[model samples]
Target: MGHPLLRRRLLLSLPLAAATAGGLGFYILLERARQGTYNPQTFSNPLVGHRVPDFRLVGIDGKHGFGSSQLIASKKPILLNFFASWCVPCAGEAPYLDVISKSGVDIWGIAYQDKAKALAFYLAKYGDPYTRLATDPTGRTAINFGVYGVPESFLIAPGGIVRWHIAGPLVPPIINEQLRPELQKIA
Candidate 1:
């Protein structure tokens, strides 16, 4: 038989155990609700305000590649877009990116781990907005920029400094309100 003191202690701990369990359950429920309510798709990149390493980019031609100097020598700011043919959001943002390019913004497209043929098809369907295009077949460039997903854009200054980074689709409002002002400054 258990001692009376031990029995009493066990009974006293029951309420504390129940309270702890209830608190943990509540936390889990709140977390689930929070995640469900938010997009949860975007990631904040830590590379903002830093200079990206210079690398060669093949100018939409798989055979011939160009160095980073060509892009850096430009006076205007460059929009470096990382996208994949398989990403649905990339399709959604394609038109906006085209519009940005047409507005005299230099957009450099990096095909993130995508096949060149599929990339051509996607560009043909969505409209090619890139001033210069390249492919990152191994996603090494994406990893360097801390890209966890597709449809990420980095606004790079002429000196190769990464000024701003956006993680999702480049919608019209974002273009008009946020990007335009910053671009004006750089211009």
Candidate 2:
């Protein structure tokens, strides 16, 4: 058997080894990004420019539901936002989304892997900006949209085709520079 001191030393090295591995992983990611070859797992949606998948999800309100048609038939451009109550960036981006909704844009919020009670509480806390909110607790719909993370959004044109996709929170610059210009075309 090993000496007791040797066993203790080995045990104590576990955390150091784990930390070194984690640091090395991060450094590799950084170097990859610096080389301009970094494609984040969430960097692009394969569903972009494709027809939205048909899905019928019940709303948190318990009164209505929505599907791809709701997004496709909008007179104005529709923004389909995928979020979860548990997501931090979703919370941070909520207010701006509310503002966008109020500016005559149609927004359909998809609750990815979230429960109804939590969604109600989240909306009550953050403000409900969704024209209609649909629950995707099973993550089936998220897969159809090529969503790997929360706070992703798709701009669907009037003909049911996805125009552009944003795989992050709706910041002001993105809203202005990317979204607004595209919205104008569909307007």
Give TM-scores for every candidate, taking all chains together and pairing residue i with residue i.
Answer: 0.74, 0.76
Q: Give the TM-score of candidate 2.
A: 0.76
What does candidate 2's lDDT look like per residue over 1-187, in tens digits?
Answer: 7999999999999999999999999999888555433436556677778889888888775767788877677666789999999999999999999899989898889999998888889999999998887888899988988888898999999878999998888877678878999988777
Residue 45 Cα positional deviation in candidate 2, in Å, after optimal superposition: 1.5
Number of the predicted model whose lDDT against the real structure is largest: 2
What is candidate 1's lDDT per residue for 111-157, written digit by digit as tens? 88888788889989999888778888888778888988898888988
Question: Model 1: how large is the Cα RMSD against the reference?
Answer: 7.8
The CA lDDT of each predicted structure is: 0.80, 0.86
Candidate 2 residue pairs in backbone clash: none
Q: Estimate the Cα RMSD of every predicted model relative to the unseen true structure.
A: 7.8, 11.2
Cα misplacement distance, residue 71 of candidate 2 (Å): 2.4
> Could you tell me the lDDT of residue 21 within candidate 1?
100
- Model 1, residue 63: what's the lDDT? 54
